[model samples]
Target chain A: MKTLVYVAHDNVHLGDATLATVTAASKLGEVHLLVAGAGCGAVAEAASRIAGIGKVHVADDAACEHQLAENIAPLIAGLMTDHDAVLFPATTTGKNIAPRVAALLDVMQISDILSVEGERTFTRPIYAGNAIATVESSDAKLVITVRGTAFDKAEAEGGAAEIAAVASTDDAGKSSFVSAELAKSERPELTSAKIIVSGGRALKDSATFENIVMPLADKLGAGVGASRAAVDAGYVPNDYQVGQTGKIVAPEVYIAIGISGAIQHLAGMKDSKTIIAINKDEDAPIFQVADIGLVADLYQAVPELTAAL
Target chain B: MKALVPVKRVIDYNVKPRVKADGSGVDLANVKMSMNPFDEIAVEEAVRLKEAGQIDEIVVVSIGPAKAQETLRAALAMGADSALLIETEEAIEPLAVAKMLKAVSGEVEPGLIILGKQAIDDDSNQTGQMLAGLMNLPQGTFASKVELEGDHVRVTREVDGGLETVRLSTPAIITTDLRLNEPRYASLPNIMKAKKKPLEIKTPADYGVDIAPRLKTLNVSEPPVRQAGVKVADVDELIARLKAMGVA
Candidate 1:
């Protein structure tokens, strides 16, 4: 079966970079891609290296940037003929675009997928990632947004495939971008990061937030995060916020500082492999799930830890 | 000015979802269901904006089945002015839901539209943005703080990277993040009033919408189980154990 995975590039010719482990999913049939028109050549060359991938389709177009629903949704719907199924990295962009595309194709969408068990059955999160639910797509064509971290990266092999130019669909009337404000980040993207360090409102002040958390994160080569409480308290920016309503993170080492773990808050980071809590309140809820609980004031402990590192 | 707060009926977030023996879906036969926790936050914010005298009236609207009326009533009990239920027997796709909201928005003439960032059941999180797109209005998505000033609503929105403050003109849409507020419970008097308050039920047919579902479900299954690890007695031991797993 021919499968297409969308990659983040100017267009879709780029290869699938899977750094994580693969289970039965790694064995899916010939993998192909539909990337942006701008870098279609480069993307196609890269896709050739993915061990299981056979063909590459470049839907290269300037309009493809940002992967807006109007243009990409119809484009994906048209491409359904060439493949048995389609896959997307379960990022925010994928979440918005995938289902809309599925709708346009009149097909079912299995999203935020953690695993693929069969030709039609998929496992996904339920109740905000607290539990997993297995879903089956009865439709002939399956479209899914797979959680990128959960899958093993397709190994690269040097064999290029010809890039097929799928006809473009004009979405001039769909929607126009008034403006977008993408938060500037100096660290690795949150979902893809290996380590994450988060804080909460107990830090008391916004100015003190960066001072108390950033340095420690810098030392550990970790992404910085804040509990929804801290963001709502206006102590940090939303991009730094991690929780049920924010982002679900599963880093190798997750350090929670001054956070009182609400179920919503825990929903985001509880999936992390190693959990460490640093809070003055020994009774803080975060300590309950923490692999390491430090009973010390964040104001004092943060600076000390930064200096020690 | 009229303000519209969209409510979502989802599995009570506090309760864990269990799969049925048949693998059909979550075993919700008797599981607790409530207004999506985030919708409660949206309702609370709109109510506060109304109570603080910044907004005139609040309407809670749900785009679901007859059962969704329960969610709308819950919003009314929390101090909304009225309730609207877009009764669609079939599951309403986000795009279609956005389209219906735009049509209703034209009639209600709301200065602000407040809804949860994502519904817990599907977690699509697209309706708000799609609605804004169809209406050609600005949006404050994942807002943590919002204020009404002059002709603009200065909102602090949660972006993937950080917070952004946008000054959207009066008729803009805002989706509430979970931490937007710790929702207030319905008071006794308001609950009593909500029972008597008028609830306008308009089917999608009434709105002249077809309400066709765009996406279909193939199958729903459970995620892989992570083994619960043993608890450690001390920090040193914990670190040592984590290091052994190469997870520290």
Candidate 2:
């Protein structure tokens, strides 16, 4: 199978999710990458170095600067002539664009596959990861979004592949870029972090959450995360939320502070290698999945833990 | 300008689904169903837009079995002017659903369309973007906040990183995220009034769309359960355990 993986990037640096996606694509067969953005030659160059990629196709044009679905879908669909399957990283951008391509190609999309069972068969979580469904596609062409944490990241530096330029398609003139407010943080991104320290509504407000969570996260070189209750209570930004509706992370260690593990929250982080929970309530659901449970008030324990670390 | 909101009746968010012993799919024989949480937000946003004078009419639609009319009536009670139900018993994929909605859009000619990002049942976040692709319309997906300008709409999107604002011309598509708005409950009087609202029932055949499943579910099963581990007496023991596991 010839699979085309959409390279997630910011026109300069390739996204970490793309490397994992390439690994997922490599499992099927030959993997080719599509780098669609304005002046993204560096991204194409980075994609070519990923271990098993066969080719890097660059669509350098102004229309794709924002990676808008209106401009990127047609470009990917047109490139589907030679590829049997098109894979995306299942990031926000991938989720936004892949559906348009699937619709344009008139195929059903298998989203956030956990494993590739057969050439056309895969398993995906439904009902917020409560049930797993194995599905097979009979379509002539396949469109899929891969969950990044389910696969290991491909080696960043290794083989050299040929980079070729593809003709850019015209803009659909439907949507236009206005502005973006991305959080600027020095901490490792939550999805790729080695360790994550997440807080819940028990922190009370934003100031207390930042004071309590950030100190421990900073000391441990961990990414800061929050439960949906924290985000809904205005204790943290939405991007900091780690749950079924938020970012899914399976890091080396995940420490839940005062989070009464809702099923949705557990869905995102239960796959972590080491799970630790620190909550006052001994009967919190978080203890069910926690590898190490510490029944304590977070106010006293978190500060002590940070000092010890 | 008229607004269209598409809602889906799915296993309620509060209900835990159980896989069938026969491996057919999640058991829904006697499961409680409600409007998909995000679609309820979509309906709420449309009602707010109508109340704000930015929208002249609100038309809600659902593509499901006959019972979906209850979901449509719920939307009607929430301030939608009318409703449409594309009745079908067979399971329809997102691509087919988008195609049917495309035909509905042709007849409705809505200036704005709002839909849930994904249904909790299938969890396939595709229909809105697919419908936008099929109709060649602008799309602002995962919108947290939406405001109308003179001829364009400004939408604040909830992305993986943070918030992004985009401006799109009229006759566009917007999919609601979790933070869009808190949905309103249908009051007693409004529920009674909704019984008299217009609701038209159609089929995929009526719109020349094929409601076929392209993907086949080979089996359905439960995910592996995570085992609970040891409890630590204090932070020191937790640190020691983490260190022993080489994760601290």
The prediction achieving the highest lDDT against the true structure is 2
Model 2 achieves a DockQ score of 0.87
Error of 1 at A284 (Å): 4.0
Q: State each model's C-alpha RMSD to the native.
A: 5.4, 0.9
Q: Candidate 2: lDDT of A128? A: 96
lDDT of 2 by residue, A31-99 (tens): 999999999999998989999789999999999999999999999999999999999999999999999
lDDT of 1 by residue, B91-204 (tens): 676767877888899888999999887888777666776676566566666777888886778777655545556567768888887556778989899898999988999888
Q: Residues A224-294, candidate 1, lDDT per residue (tens digit)?
A: 88887898788876677787667778888888888988867887887788787877777777777787777
Best by DockQ: 2
